[model samples]
Target: MRNKGPKIIILTASYGNGHLQVANSLYQECIRRGYDNVKICNLYTESHPFISEVTEKLYSKSFTYGKQFYKLFYYGTDFIQNKKMLRWYYQYGFKRLTSLIETEEPDILINTFPINAVPEFRRRTGIVIPTFNIITDYCLHSLWLHDDIDKYYVASNELKAKIHSRGVTESKVVVSGIPIRPSFSQSLDKSMLFDKYQISPKKDLILLIAGAHGVLKNIKETCETLLLKTDHQLAVVCGKNHSLRNEMAQLENKYRDRLHCFGYLERIDELYRIASVMVTKPGGITLTEATATGTPLILYMPVPGQEKENARFFSEKGAALTAKNQEELLNSIDSLLKSKQKQLSLQLSIKKLYLPSSQEMIMTDILKESEKISRMKNHSTIKSQKKKLGS
Candidate 1:
C-alpha cells in the first residue's frame, strides 16, 4: 500500500532529544521503505523564535541544575494544565502553530512530542487532517489529550491502557512501541564489536549515557566510583555536553585502556549492541534503544514525573533495576557482573518488552492514513464537479 501523494510531515520540538530522535528515525524508515515524500520539521524553531529560545534555555537549565529544575517545569505545566486560565494561553500558543501547519499543508501529521499536539487540536476547530500523536515517553500527560488526534502510537500496552483509562478510545490507541532506529534492532557479536572498539570481551561492559542535554548530577563522582572498584569496561557518552567531555578527558587518559568517552555520537547503536548493561537516566529514547539492543538497564537519577514513572515501570517489569544512591549503584554493578544468570534474565525480559520494528510499523500506519485522506479528498472533489455539471 504505497502512498502516492504529498509528503507526510513529522513535527517535533527541542525540549528533549527524544522527540527529534524518534522523528528522524521514522523519517529515515520512511525513506528506506521507498517513501521519500517525508519531511521532519522542528516545529518549535519553525513556528516561534522567542518561545524556542525560552524552551532551549529551559533545557539548558535542566541539565545544569539537574532534576529539581526539570521537575519544577514539569509540575508547573501540570499546574497550568489543571487550571482554566491556561486554556487561553494554550489557544494563543497554538494560533501561531496552526499558521505553520497551514503553510506546510502536509497530507498527514505525526507529532513526536506532546507540545505540538496543541496545534492539531486548535487547527481542527475549523479544519481537519489525518493526525497521529506518537507519545515519545512511556507515560502520557495532559498535553496529549486531544480530541482531534486520529490515532496514537504509544510505547507499551500499559501506556495505551492508561490513556484509555483517561477517556481516550481504546480503538484509537496502538502500542507500537517507541520509534527507535533500525540499528537497535540488529544483532552484533560481542567479540566482533569489542574488536572494532579495541575493547576486551573478557571484561564486563558498562555503558553510561546522559540524557539529550547531558543533565546528570554528580556524574564526576559516578565515573570515579565505577573506575575505582569495578572489573568492568566503561563507555561514557556525554551527549551534547561539551564541557563534560572536556572534563572527562583527563579521566579517559588515566583509564585509557578501559574507559571510552564520546560526545554527541551518531552511532550509539554500536555501543548499545556490545554492552552487558547500560547506566542511564530513564529517558524514553535511551531506554527504548537499550531495550531494542537487549541490554539490561541500571536506571539512575531520573527526573521526577514522567521520567520517574518510566524508571519505575521498566524496573518493576524486570527489564531494568533502579539505583537510588552511590552504594546501590556499585552493588548493582557488582551483582550484575558476577551473576551472568541475572544479566541473562534482564536481557530476556528486555527482549520480551521491546517492539523491534516499531519505527516501520508507525511509518506504515502514517502512510496508510495519508492515502485514505487523499482518497476522500479526491472523491469529494469529483462529487462536487458532478453536482455542478448536473446543475
Candidate 2:
C-alpha cells in the first residue's frame, strides 16, 4: 500500500556537509515511504548564487587558513541572534524563492539550515503551510529558533531541554536524534566487507576521515603516527580535496600493502564497517554515523563553534576521546588500539547513544500532523460554504 502523504520541499544549504547530509537522508526516507512529490532545494545556490559563492569561499578559507578569524566570528555571532539580519536575508531571498514555492505548491517545508526565509515566504504569500526545522547540531543556536516553526527535531534530550529553556514549548521539540542514512544502521559481515575492500581480515583497521572539504591539518602526520605506532591497516579518505589526496597518494609507496587511499568515496559505510577505530573531526553527521556504526572515535582538532560542543558532548558520554594536538592524537589512538576491552567499552557507549529509528519517527510525526491540518482546513471550507448558502 502506498502512503498518501503531503508533498514536501526540503530546504538545505551547503555551508557544511552535515546540513546537506541530513536533508538527503530525509529525502531518501520520504521516497522509500512512497512520497511522490519530494524535492530538495539548495537555497543559497539557487536563490542567491553570488552571495553563496562569496560566503562559501570565506567559509573554506576560515577553516583552512583563517582559524582565528573563524573562531572569533563564530563565537561573536553565537549570542547576537538579530531578527534584522534574518529580515534582510528574507528580503533578499523573497523574489527568487517565492516563484519557486508558488509553482511547487508544497504541503510542507522542512529546513535543515538556519535560513530564516521560510517565515517570510509565509508572511508575504499568506500561505499556511506547516514548517519543520531539523537542527543540525548537538547544541542549539538562537538563529534556528523562530516563531513560525511548527516542530523541531533535535539530537538529544539535553538539546531538547536547552531549546525548551529558550521559551520554545516542550511539545514543539522532538528528540529524534540526528538523521543519518540507513546504510550506517544495517548489519554488515565484516569479513566479507574486508575481503571486498582487499583489506587484511586479521589486522585491526584504522580509518581516518577529514570531512567533506578535507581540511584537517597534518593529515600526513596523523597517517604516519598510526602506521608507526600500531600494527593496523590504514584507510584514509580525502574528501573533495585533490591536493590532500595527492599528498596522501605519495605515501602509498612507503606504506605499500598497508595503506588504502581514496578520494570522495560514496561507500563510506563500508569503510566504517571494517574499521575498529576511527579518527575524525567532530562534524555532527560524521559523529552520528560513527556512533551508529559503533566505531570508537578519536576527535581531532574540531572547529570552534558547534564542532567543539559536539566533541564535548561525545567525550562526556565516554563514547569518544578528544585530542588537541598531534601528540595527543597519536597517544589517544595508541591507547584505544592497545586495549580491546577499552575499545569495546567505547563502542558500547556509542551503541547506547545511537537511535536507528530517528528517520522513521520523524516521518511518522510529520504525516500525522499533516493529516490533522488537512482535516481542519476541510472543516473550515465546509463551514464557509454553509455560511454563503444561508446568506
Candidate 3:
C-alpha cells in the first residue's frame, strides 16, 4: 500500500515559522495517511544558504526596522508575473529545484511557501508533475501567483476571488483554511493542560505569542499591563528568542504565581486549548490555529503588508480585535475579559472562519491532484507505445 502512494515533495522556506509549520502539518498528514514517500524541501536554504540567511534576517527585521521598504516590495511586485524582469527572481532556487525533481521524480510538488521557481521550472522544462500552492495567509499576494500552479489552497473566499482577479481561473482555487497541526482540531484535556503547566484554572489565561523568532514587539509592556490591571494569569511564549526568554525569566520570577513563560513549545495547541485570550502578531498559521481552537485573538500592532492584511481580515470578519498600540491593546483585552458576551462573540466569529479539519482537506486535495497527473502520464505513455507499434 505504501509503495502505491504517490511520492510528494513539499517546497518551503524558513523566512519565518509560518511556511515551515504548514509544511510540517502536510508532512504529518501524509505520514498518517500512509504516504511514507513524502518529502519536505527547504528549497531556499538547501539551494542557497547564504542568500536564504541574508533574506531571513532582512525579513525578520522588516516588520520593525524595514517595514516601509517591505510594504513597497510586497506591493510593487503584485504583477511581477507579467513582467520580463521577474525572471531574475525565478532563478532563486530554480536550478536546485530542477535537479531535485530530476533526481526524486516526485509524483507531485506542493509549495508551502511562495517560490517562483516552481512555476518557472515547470513552464521552462515543460514537466507535467502536479504542483499546488498552500497559501499560509489570510490575504493574497502576487508572489503566490503563477499560471503554472495547478491549484491553490487559500484561507478564504476573499483570497480565492483575489486569485481569480489576478487572471487565474476560478477552478484553480480552493478556500481551504491554512493547515495547522491536527491537534488543534482534536479534543484536548483542559484539566490536564492546566495541571501539566501548573496553570491556575481560577484565573483567566492571557496567552501572548512572540512567534518563532520572538518578532512580536513590546511584549514586556503588554504582559505587564495585563498583570497590573487585570486579575488574569499570563502564559508567554518567547519562541527561539533567547534574549527575550532571558528577559521573561525575570518577569516569570516576579509574577511567579501568576506568570509562566516558555520557549519553542512542542505542544502549542495545548496552550491554545487553555488560553482565554491570545495576543500576538498576526501570522496566518498562528491566527488559523487560534481560529481552530476557538480562542479569542487580539492581533497586536501588525505592520504593513501581509501581517496587517491578515489582521484586517480577521478583524473585519469579527473573528479578532486589532490594537495599534499598548493602550488600544489593553483596552481591547479589558473589554474581552470583562464582557462575557464580547469573548463569546469573538469565539463564535472565529468558529465561522474555521474550515473543519483543514489539514485533512489539503492533504486529500494534494493526493487527488497527484493521482490525476499520474493517470495522465500513464495514458500518454500507453498512447506513445501504441503509436510506435503502429509505425
Candidate 4:
C-alpha cells in the first residue's frame, strides 16, 4: 500500500557533499516524523552521469590547478543569471526528472541544490507543484532564484536579505539556518569520546575534516605541522578519501600517542562534541555542523568561490576565524588551545550562529507548506467540478 501522507521529493546534487548533506538531513527528519513518501533524487547524477562525472572531476581539480578558472566561472555566472539562457540547462534532466515526478506524484519539490530546472519546467510546462529552494551556503547565487519557486530557505539572515535585494520577497524567505542533523544539537559525554577514541583529555583536540570524496590540499604537511608544533591531540576525519585515510593511518602510527585518524563515519556528533577546535575547509555543511556543536573553528584556506564567501560570513559574524595557510592555521589553533577565554568566546559566537533544532524547524515549515498546497489543490478540484456542472 502507498503512504497517503504528504509526498515530498527533495532534489539535491553531490558536486560536493554540502547540497546532499542538507537533503539527507531533511529526509532523515521526515522519516523520523513518519512521513513515508519522502524521497531524495540526486538530479544531476541520476539524469546525466557523464556530465556529472566530468564536472565532479573538474570541481576537485579546481582546488589545485584551476582555481582561477573556477573563480571566473563562479563569479561570471553568478553575476548574471540569465533565465532565458537557462533554458539550455532546463532541458538537461527534463525527461528523467519529469518521469520521477509523474511516478512519485510528489506534492512538493524541495531543492537543496540550485537545480533551477524544476522552476524552469514549471514555467514552460504549466505545472504548479510547490517548489522550495534551500540555499545550501551562507551566500546567495542568482542561479538559486526563480519566480516560480514558492519559497526560499536560507542559512543566515544576511543571505535572506541578499535574496530579498535580488527581488525575492521578504515574505517568501525563511532564515532556517543550514539544516544539520539534530544529533549535533545535543551534548555527548567527553569522557566516553576520549575512551572510545583512545585519546587523552590532557591535550586539546584539533579536528581536521577532509570532506567526503575530497582530499585536503597538502594534508600530510598540515598533519605534520599540528603534531610537531603543538601539545594538542589531533583527529583527522578523512571522509571517503581512501587514499588520504591510508596516508593518515601511516601518520597515526608514527604519532601513535597523539594522532588519531578515521575514515568516513556514519555519526560524527561525538567527535564534534569532543573537539577543542575544528581545522577544515569552509564547506557550508561542515561549518554548520561545527557551529551546531558550538565548536570553535579555524577555517583553513577557504577556496575562492562559495568557500571564501562562507568563511567571510562566519568571520564577519565573529563566529569563526579564517587562516590563509598551513602556518596561519597552526597559529590560530595554537592560540585557540592556549587561551581559555578565547576558546569560550569563539564557542559562544559559534553557538549563536545556529538555531536550536534547524532540521525540525525546516521539516515543520515544509509540512505546513505541504498542507497549504493540498488545501489549494482540493479547492481547485472542487471549483473545477462545480464549473463543469454549471456548463
TM-scores of the candidates are: 0.89, 0.93, 0.95, 0.95
Q: By lDDT, who's the top model here?
A: 3
Q: How far is 95's C-alpha from truth in model 2 (Å)?
A: 2.4
The residue ranges of model 1 lying beyond 4 angstroms of the native Cα positions read 1-4, 63-66, 75-84, 92-96, 116-125, 373-391
> Candidate 1, residues 1-391: lDDT per residue as tens digits?
7665556778788877888889998888877777767888786676677878886887767645656877876777755545354565455347556676677666677888775445445455655667888998877776776667778999899999988987889988988999887777666776787888888888888988876677766677888888897668899889988898999999999999989989987778898888888888888898888877888889986668787888888988899989887788878988987899999999999888788789888878777776786688789889999999999
RMSD of each: 3.2, 2.5, 1.9, 1.8
Error of 2 at 234 (Å): 1.0
Better of 1 and 3 by TM-score: 3
Q: After superposition, how far is residue 197 of candidate 4 from its true place, in Å?
A: 0.7
Better of 1 and 4 by lDDT: 4
C-alpha RMSD (angstroms) for model 1: 3.2
lDDT (10s digit) by residue, model 4, range 348-378: 9988888767778877887787688768978
Q: Between the candidate structures 2 and 4, which one is better when assessed by TM-score?
A: 4
Candidate 1 to truth, TM: 0.89
Per-candidate local distance difference test: 0.79, 0.84, 0.89, 0.85
Least lDDT summed over 10 consecutive residues: which range in candidate 2? Answer: 85-94
Off by over 4 Å in 2: 1-5, 377-391
**316 Cα displacement, candidate 4 (Å):** 0.4
| lDDT by residue for model 2 (1-391), tens | 5536677999998788889999999999899898878999997789889998888888877766777888787776667767775566557566766877789888888899987788777766666778889988888778788887889999899999999998999999999988998888788898899888889988888899977999778988878877886778999999998998999887867898899989998889899888978989888899888878888888898878788889999999999999998899888887888899999999999878787777899888877776776678789889999999999
Give candidate 1's error at residue 319 in angstroms: 1.0
